[model samples]
Each structure stands twice: as C-alpha cells, then as structure tokens.
Target: MHPAGPAAKVIATLWWVLLGGATAIFLFVAGLIAWAWYGPSGERDEWGYVIGLGLVFPLIVLAALLAYGLVVGERLLPRPGPDVVRVQAEARQWAWRFGYDDAPDRETENVLHIPAGRPVDVAITTADVIHAFWVPRLAGKLDAVPGRVNVLRIEADRPGRYEGLGSEFNGPGYRDHRFSVIAHDAASWDRFLQGDAP
Candidate 1:
C-alpha cells in the first residue's frame, strides 16, 4: 500500500477493490448458507438466488474489474509527453544496464537515475532469456524479451531512492538481479546529466 507513483497508486487501488469484491462474495455465500440452514421454512426464490445473486452479480463485478483494469492499463502506457524522460534498459543474465536519451554515451549498471515528479519511459529489452523489469513502489512489471522492446512507464513523486529488481526466474543468479532507482531533484538531475555523481 506504500505507493510512490501514479502507476503504483492505481495498482494499490486495484488490490483494495479486489479485496472488497472477494469479501462481498464471501459474505454473500455465507448468507446463503445461513439462510439454507437456519432461516424460517418458506418457498424461496430459487431462480433469483441462483441466477441473479450467483451468476449475474459475479459477472457484473468481474466486468467492472475488467473495465477498471483496461482503463488503468491504458493510462499506465508510455505515452509521449514534453517532459518525459526516455531511458534504454537492457537486461542480461543477472545485471541491468540503463542508458539515458540525453546522454547517449553515458550508461549506468544496476543504478537508474530519473528526475523526480516526471514520467519516465523505459524501453526494456533482454540480451539473453526473458526477464521482468519491476519496481514495485513505482509501477508494474513488464517482460524484457530478447529482440523485442517493451516500454514501461514509471515515475517518482518526490526525490528519493527506491528498490528495483528483475522478477523472472532466468537463472540461478536471478536472486541477485536487483537494482536501485535514484529519483533526483531538478538540480541533481541536471548535475548528474552533466557528469556529477547522483
């Protein structure tokens, strides 16, 4: 529930909504069980309970969840923006390489630097087997497939450091395939772009 960016916020909200839907379903089933065992004897609307409560309600809830996911997924895409920072990410067996669009020759390994409060579009690919790019507090995961690039949108609301990792089980060294994200302020970002340590 500790979300540091917009995408993470949406995902956290989705989790809460899923929990609520599950709770509602559980309560409904429990109510049905109680009614079946302890309620006063009467001719219940069997069709109504079976069709309306059992099928229709669940379908409606599922449809709503799907709609919400679609909308949220669209919003999280790496859309073009004036302030968007583009970065290239290449995943290997147990390492990550991050290169900036502004500084093409400069690349960082296992340490990604992004400006705070701005959307970043990371173009991800893999050198070998498929891997997953994930920064849990910032956004969802995207596969880094060989010979194909996948763009994942991520951002930080403020200047801070966050943890990132490759989530796929590519090899025995996968457990150490971790990284860090340093979200810098405007000045810090500029300095880092100009050859200063972040």
Candidate 2:
C-alpha cells in the first residue's frame, strides 16, 4: 500500500531544499537589519523596514512553526484522505485543462478552482514533453513527465486569484503557457461545483 499520510516526508524534504537557501538569505538580511537599527541606536535608517520585519514577522513565524513541529511531531504532517481535493492537470500543445472530481462534466480550461484553506492534491502528468506547474503564491511546482505522475500537495490560505506558470521550455509559446488559480470559500466552492460562476 501507499504511505499512510500525504507523503509528508517528501513535502518536508522539498520544502527544506527550496526554502533553506531563502532562509539563509533572510537571516543574513535580518542581521543587517538589526545592526542597522539597534546596533548603534544610531541605527542605519535605510534598514528600518528590514529590521522591523526581522524582529516581529519573519522570525516570529519561523519560531512558531519550529515550536509546533517540535510539539506535534509527526502529527503536523498532512494526512491522505477524502477531503483532500485532487486535481489532474493535463498540458497539451499550449493550454492547461484542470479536472476536478467535483467538476466532472467539463474540465476548467486555463483556470484552476480550489477551495481556500483545504489541502489540494495534484497528480500531474504531461501528454508530451516535460512541463512544470508552478504557482509561487501557493506552493512550488513539480515536473510533469510523460509517463510518470508526480503528486503535489498545495494549500492556499487566502481566497483570491493567483497566477501559475509553466517553467519548462517545451517549445514555442512557452512564455504564454500560463494559467490562473481561483481560490474560493466553502460556499463559493459549492456554487462553483453546481455550475455557478464564481
């Protein structure tokens, strides 16, 4: 049988690999921020914004998550279950067709509809050359190979429209291979499933 959970190991591995570098950069900037602001009290005024974020926002979030991870341990991982929305994204010559279980009649072309705050599981495979599905605001993109299906777990906390781009340069018009993601509230999601425009 497959792993019992949402393959948290894979997600965590990917997260650290991608964010580790960014975290280092953030820490370096944060240190500069502190030195500029509080090191002298005769602080570097130009770093005012960075210092503020270092003290309160970025570090705070990192701490909170660290604490949670330490406390909850394995429970912090996402579990595989029915509630996880599964999306099958198929890429053709130049467009994306997103198929969701709730929308069986017709695939949403060029638009991905997801319910905000819920876990979205995507099993992506390309019909042709390699392609990558990337939505920076929500989650990192994974490669979609012709014969292999890659699974991605994504969660969008806010309800809004976000942009997704195809990172792999398959051929011509690669730049134009982009789509939009629409995150909706529960009620709006229901309406959308019922064929209502959201």
Candidate 3:
C-alpha cells in the first residue's frame, strides 16, 4: 500500500529499518550457531565478537531506533497553523462520527473529507468505550478514550480515497467499524466546504 503522507512515510521507513536490522541479526546468529555446531572446535577467542554483536549491537541499534521514533513522533504532533484544517472525530459503540470545525452543523458518519496537500488535525475522543482510530496509509493509530481528546495530524499527498478503521474492539459491531477518508483537490475541497457535495 502507498503511504499517503509524511507521517505514514516515516513510519514505513522505520518499519523497513527495523525489519532489515532484525533480519541481519537473525542471519548472523544463525551463522554463528552453524559454525559452532558443524565446524572444527579450535581454540579461538570469539567471546568478544559474541558479546559485541549480541549485546552492544542491539543496545546501540535500539537506542538509535528509539531516538528516531521520538523525532518522527514529534513531527506528527498537531501544530497550530493558519492553513490547518481541524475536525472532530468521535467514536461510540461501533461507529465513527466526523464533524468539521468550520461547519459545526455539518457532520459525516464513517466518512471523512479533507483537502489534499494540507495538514488536517483530527481531535479524537470516545463517547463510550475506548477505541483507536487508524488509517494505515495516512498516519499511525491514536487511541480514543472517554473524557480525553487526542489530536492526530493527517494529510494526503494527493486526492484519493484511503481506508480507516477502529483498531480497538469495543463491541459486537466492532468488526464493521470502518471508515473512508476522501481527499479532494483544492477546488473540489472548496466545493465540499461550501456544502455542495454530500
């Protein structure tokens, strides 16, 4: 799947980095095991190699990964901007409701409309049980807890439709708790804002 925006792109990058690192370590360990089991037992001092690779390497990699994750997470936080679009996302039972701050009375269920190439901040909360709003191609999952608002920033690189869902199971209808994000171009997005589209 294509990553629709910067946050997803960063997450995708980190995923690949983690995967590659883990694969490399696995292969190295496997090779060491094979050598120890099959090769001739010689008086070789390889304790340093084992300790360095098994302990020091993982420690360094984990620290670097943590730092990178924090940096990316900070970038994903919602920032006040003149051009930023704000929307309210409410979860209850097994449905999602989206409301635009610009048009208080206008609301959409299970479908969110946003402008492409612009930052959109979604203030997420739950009316009942806890849930998680997740759009893999757009951004990471953010928990929606009762009495708490969690804001997440999402953007589309281009005009398209992306899939979203309630990642946390709350009730029997949780399996159907899916949503779609429709990203429109500047002109079409303006028309949507003008209440010209349903």
- Name model 3 segments beyond 4 Å from true: none
Over 3-79, each residue of candidate 2 has an lDDT whose tens digit, in order, gives: 11233344455466447645765877778756665676643455565567555566766676566555554543446
Q: What local lDDT score does residue 94 receive in model 2, on the 0 to 100 scale? A: 87
Lowest lDDT block of 10, candidate 3 = 49-58
Q: Which one wins by TM-score: 2 or 3? A: 3
Ranking by lDDT: 1, 3, 2
* Model 3 C-alpha lDDT per residue in residues 87-184, reported as the tens digit of each score: 99999887899999877778999999999999999999999999999999999999999999999999999999999999997878888889999999
My TM-score estimates for the predictions, one after another, are 0.95, 0.62, 0.92
**For model 2, which pairs clash?**
36-44
Which TM-score value belongs to model 2? 0.62
Instruction: For each candidate in the order shown, give its overall lDDT on alpha carbons.
Output: 0.91, 0.74, 0.89
- For model 2, the stretches where C-alpha displacement exceeds 4 angstroms are 1-78
Scored by lDDT, the top model is 1
TM-score-better candidate, 1 vs 3: 1
Best candidate, TM-score? 1
